[model samples]
Target: MYRYTEFDKSFVKSRAAQFRDQLERWQDGRLSEDAFRPLRLQNGWYVQRHAPMLRVAVPYGELSSAQLRVLARIARDYDDPDPDVYRVASAAQGKLGTERLPTHCAHFTTRTNVQFNWIPLEKSADVMDLLATVDMHGIQTSGNCIRNISCDERAGVAPDEVADPRPFAEIMRQWTTLHPEFAFLPRKFKIAITGASEDRAATAWHDVGLQLVRNETGELGFRVSAGGGMGRTPVIATLMREFLPWQHIMNYIEAIVRVYNRYGRRDNKYKARIKILVKAEGQRYIDDVDEEFRQIVEHDGAPHLITPAELERVRASFVPPALHASHASHASVDEAEANANGHPLFARWLQRNVAQHKDPALRIVTLSFKRLLQSPGDATADQLDIVADLADRFSAGEARVTHTQNVVLPWVRASELLALWQAAREAGFASANVQLLTDMIACPGGDFCALANARSLPVAQAITERYQDLDELDDIGEIDLHISGCINSCGHHHSGHIGVLGVDKDGREWYQITLGGSDGSATSGAPQPGKVIGPSFSAAEVPDAIEAILTTYRDAREHDERFIDTVRRVGLTPFKTSANAVRVNEEVSA
Candidate 1:
């Protein structure tokens, strides 16, 4: 893990003090909520359902064992002390031990946002101290400012990658942190980098998605996609630069951000994301503007922000770990094969959840959170603590959170598979359903989110319950059912095998279904929604609609076809007819 330098520590300390002063002024009534809002947001504080929630940024979802320990300590000291507050109490107790009590702290990782949130605000200083110890500060994790620069979690480890993207991500992080020139944007701007063969970073859904690749001449370069985003109107990013040299990545990004800062919409917050700009003024104009800015910056070095040496310094912090050749042995392979059938329940898990590693004997173990009858993305604080401990014990003292909202123990030895699985089972994270239909992605709708038109979690639960048979799910093959509350697309419904979007129709909750959407490298287009379905039904009808769709797909699909492929071939008419058609017919008595 990268350690914070003296300069980094000073920056965080100064920012913390600034926030403390802001808090004092607000408490003294010198500043109102409207006045203090931006200051608090700059520090990662937000007003949530129950109380003020503070989001502590964990850059790129990478955490050292020391940082994890600090998190455990902070949870014990600051948040609510009840172990039973969340469902995974045993897991929490196992990780932090019985002596530690739960603080009100709850930890979560967003696909693109690296954040930690909790209620109450008394322990801000302690949290800042922990953060400063590492090379991290939550300077612009939130607010109407440029947010954290995200990259693929498996940047260096993935076998089919162009290069490690962490260095570039780190450089961008430093350059954008409290930058004066691009600090105040029309809306929050997000950037993602991916060096993986697969699009694990959700690159197509970001403001800037840089795909690392080699050009025709075998020189390292990037295929840049711009203005891609999710919200009311979802647009897959357009190709701005087909092939940009490696040396010009930062310079090019600076140019794009500069152009957006100058011409992006400022009149309406809803219309402010770069996607709208790209839509209103075609990609050609944006490209021309970007080229113009690039020339200007290259000539004058306008900001003089990051130099090649500075970037290399950041890159040096992310070198790959040394693995012993002897560790990759046939014995480890035999051990994995021995445990293959130890538990039939884990057969599918071992097959789908685990990722291939560079070392033949080692595998990147994925802790499956997609279990039956549980909230898709919800993990109790205790569950988090246990996973942290397991990472320390089995993996290489670190863990990576995936864009699919799951945790990955990137360096787990095959010999330790059974032990890790048992520990995970105790923690309630041993779901054994990673890519199955039960592994649904859903957003917190009317339950916790204020922006929802209808409830989504319950709908997800109903779908999971309907398809509880593991054998049936395996036979059905890979199907992604992503649900969103509204047009904001928080659950990434626009990219699901069977996308379901909740809508309000005449003051009643209804669902709009879409097919053929996918987010991986294999599939690269947004799925179109089918006809609007029935009035919001009791929980029972939700499952019925899903079953009808699945049955229709099964009947209509070609041999061994995936759901998205089938949808693409046959279209949504059959599924729509299945869902809306009457099952029982009236008897015609003569």
Candidate 2:
């Protein structure tokens, strides 16, 4: 975990003070809502249906126990306590008191950020202050700026890692913090990086994606890609550079974003993403960016270079915790294995949430926020404390958030696996549904966010309830089902194998389905963007429609094929036909 130094602390305190002044100006009518909109967005404040939503960035999904406890404190203090907010059951799903409302819950986002929904607009500064105390902030988390830099959750401890990407990710985070030149680009931008063989960060769907690669001579560099994003026109970014020297990454990235900022569309916001620029301009865009990089680095001597000392300082902050090395077998581990064998439920949890660690005696334990009966990415204030305690007990007093909206304890000992599982289960977090259909991703839809066309949380719950049978889920293995209340793609429906997008049809909520999409890791190719299946379904029909698609795949799939593989092999005709039938039958019944 990274601690704040004097300079870092000063920067956050100054920024928080600045935002507080901005909020006061708006309240005093010195600044109109229109004038303050962009400023507020830059600081991660959005006026939602019930109240303002603040997205606090958790860089690369990393957090220490102390920082998480601070977040729990914020949740307890900052959330609105209005009586009307509790009237809506979805928003108040975890109501705790005579009680409680949906007021203080925090959502862990798929982008590795935490969102405080229902926070009062007046208290945005308080939220900022809490985050600043823990070396966190919402700066550049929203708006048209480059959002948080995401990387593999298993960055340092993965055996397959060529080199940890955290140091470079932190370097980029600092450079792009508030770069005046690119802050108000055509539209929002995102970046994902990985040094691992597995694409856990979903690199292909970001505006800019980078992979750390080692050359034949064993020198490390980057393979840069541009134009990737998800929305109305989803695209997997094109590979722009085969290999860029490690020292040149700073300037090289500046050059690519500069090229996109120059030529990206401004007429229609729909066509404003860099993905559109990459798709429209094709190879010429890549050529122009390369030429710019050459001029900046070779001709002008790279004025934007990060000095070695600065790089080393940031790099040193990300060192992994010291741990006892892994072992083949140990007393605690052997006892745990025996206990797991006897307890079938614990065994199931081990098979699902646990993975092999780089340290042979250690294990990777993923805690699911998308449990069978809860909101996809939400955790109550108390739940946050539970997470903090679990991290302290088993994972070196630190935890990492995953892009899948789950928490990762990357350094838990295998010897303590059963004990950890039992503790997590007692806390209602041992869901045993990692990367399965039950582990669906969703956004805060019409229930909380004013931007949504329909409610997303209920659909996720319906699917989880409909598919609670582990045996059946195993039969239909490896399904990426993403549901978004709107086409903003916050739920990443465009990249899901079974994509569900919500639409407003004649003032009623309807869902559009898409099949054959993936986050690019399921298959041995660039991710396939989703395509519309047929007519939309009403809210009531969504669960059955999903069930029909799964059933069709089960019947039509070849031996040993995953759901994604089946969809790829058979195209959308069979699933489409069955799903449309379900849709029609429901419409007639209505």
Give lDDT tens digits, candidate 2, residues 33-97: 99999989988888886677888998889988888898888888887556655456434543122
- Which TM-score value belongs to model 1? 0.88
Whole-model Cα lDDT of every candidate shown, in order: 0.70, 0.84
**TM-score, candidate number 2:** 0.94
Per residue, candidate 1 scores C-alpha lDDT tens digits across 327-436 of 56778878877887777766666787777776777778878766654566555556667777988887777877666667788777777777887888788777777777
The candidate that wins on TM-score is: 2
Q: In candidate 2, which residue pairs get closer than 3 Å at backbone N, Cα or C atoms, i.e. clash? A: 97-100, 326-361
Cα lDDT over the full model 1: 0.70
Candidate 2's C-alpha runs over 4 A off are 81-101, 306-310, 323-335, 522-525, 588-590
Pairs with backbone N, CA or C atoms under 3 Å apart (clashes), candidate 1: 4-135, 79-103, 79-104, 80-103, 80-104, 92-382
| lDDT, residue 181, candidate 1 | 66
Query: Which whole-number lDDT from 0 to 100 does residue 1 have in model 2?
Result: 57
